[model samples]
Target: MARPRAPNRRATSCRCSWTICIEPDQGTRVKQRPGGMPPHPSQVLARRGLVTSLTWLALVAAPTVAQAQFGDPGGEGTAATDTGQIGAAALSTPRYMGADHNRLRALPYLSYRWANGWFVDGINGVGYGGSPTPGLQMGVHVGVSPDREESDDPALRGMGNVNRGAELGGFAHQRLGSWLGGKLSLRSHLRYGSGEDRQGGQAELGLGWGTRLGERSLMNLGLAANWANQGYMQTYFGVTRAQSTSSGYTEHKTDGGLRDLRLSLVVIQLFSPTTVGLLMVSQTYWQGDAADSPLVQEKRNTMAVAALMYRF
Candidate 1:
């Protein structure tokens, strides 16, 4: 698979903006604006309202609690914190890239640190890695690639479903000192998916800063870029002549490049010594040919998740 460089564009100059929102429940707040501007008008009305409403509803309907992530945005690996910690989280996200619908997911979070400087986490899937020094960590992980149903979106009327596959990858994290004496981290992930033509892997890199709001609360802000390979680009965004005819979209031949930039926020509140509440929100700005595809109805999208966790 070809690895193309991201085009020189104004979009590359944009940076992530972070805001700290504190509540009595020890919640964290995060909002992202790509290019530091409002979304395109066409997108504002199409999926913005739905995203906002769904997120708001989840926050209100969910129990007042928070959960922890395995390799959190703060650059701290969950296994390094508490070895035997175990918990679960329910996430709400869109079914597909440009879909208007959302789905609910429940998954467990686990971290086990062995005596041999090895660890495994359940949140992002089984992995072996941990923070070896004060600010550096590395690990390898293998996990299932969640499948996508073409029927989820009307625009994908004829596109075949993406089969569930596997991905194995490695990650590295480096701490960028602290923010106001709080911890900050930079992390990156490289993963290869199992597909004949989509054999190339994906790469992600991000910067994050985390702070303790109080004795029982923690919050993190993160910004990252996602790059796709030719196989991946074509798999999801490419439109063949037959597909174009069936899906009513023009043939779009996509090359590997920068797919999108993402900003994320994570907040965790410990309700009790063993119970926690978490809220995470992320915003993405699609770029290059990925955004130019006819299947892409909204170039900018929002994803929110609220979960309650109990550590045993």
Candidate 2:
């Protein structure tokens, strides 16, 4: 009985405490919608101003991108330089570049010579054998006479025909007193035809002559000057790879005339009766003809000739 009575009281109390959860703050009065869109002018104007400012910023930035990507290299405002020479100090005359004032020279020379060619008088085989020879001729040195005969050297020497091609180099005749002398020559020749691309060799020989130039002796050496008169001059001295091509051909060529410049030494072994000896040297050609046909140019040239002359 006592337990039933307490239970009944607690049950009634629990039942009464079970109330509805009415959230008072959550059920606040709702603000009614403005009837037919009433205007807020200041807020609208502020929103409109922000949109306008944003549009202006976008428009200005669009052109700036292209200007940076497409404008000239030296920024937007500089000029180029490759306009010849510049600066006040640089605009000088052509003569200012090198030694233009000093001129070279063509010195004077004197010598007596006797050069004989049976061919000169149409006497074939008259020379070098017991054959009927052409009459020889005597003349003053028939070459560009120079001031120093003992030391002067000249005209380029080629060894073979142009069809064969040849080498180029310097040749010198050193006078070693009366009656004795020697010559120095360096040259090369090339071979024709296909397959074997061979270049030739050079020979430096010594020959002697006894002339009457008193103490100034003279000598005639072996193999003076040789030439090939083909009209074309190749850029190379040999049949180098550059010189040889499938199209590069070698042909028999001629200079029209006998292209021989005999370089010999002669003397008049006595002076009381006006003894005289002659040294006839060929020209040391520069590169080629300059003012004439098939003209060539030269680099530098040095030539000289000395003779002993005795006059009665």
Model 1 per-residue lDDT at 241: 94
- Runs of candidate 1 with Cα error greater than 4 angstroms are 1-86, 104-123, 194-198
lDDT tens per residue, model 1, 60-119: 222111111124312233221223445555766655665555567775555554423354
Report the C-alpha displacement of residue 60, candidate 1, in angstroms.
Answer: 22
**Candidate 1 displacement at residue 114 in angstroms:** 4.1
Q: Which ten residues in a row have the lowest lDDT in candidate 2?
A: 64-73
lDDT tens per residue, model 2, 42-103: 11111101111111111111211100011001110110111110001011111100111212
TM-score of each: 0.70, 0.19
Q: How far does residue 65 in candidate 1 sit from its true spot (Å)? A: 24
lDDT of each: 0.54, 0.19
What is the Cα-based lDDT of residue 190 in candidate 2?
16
Each prediction's Cα RMSD? 15.2, 48.8
Residue 138 accuracy (lDDT) in model 1: 67
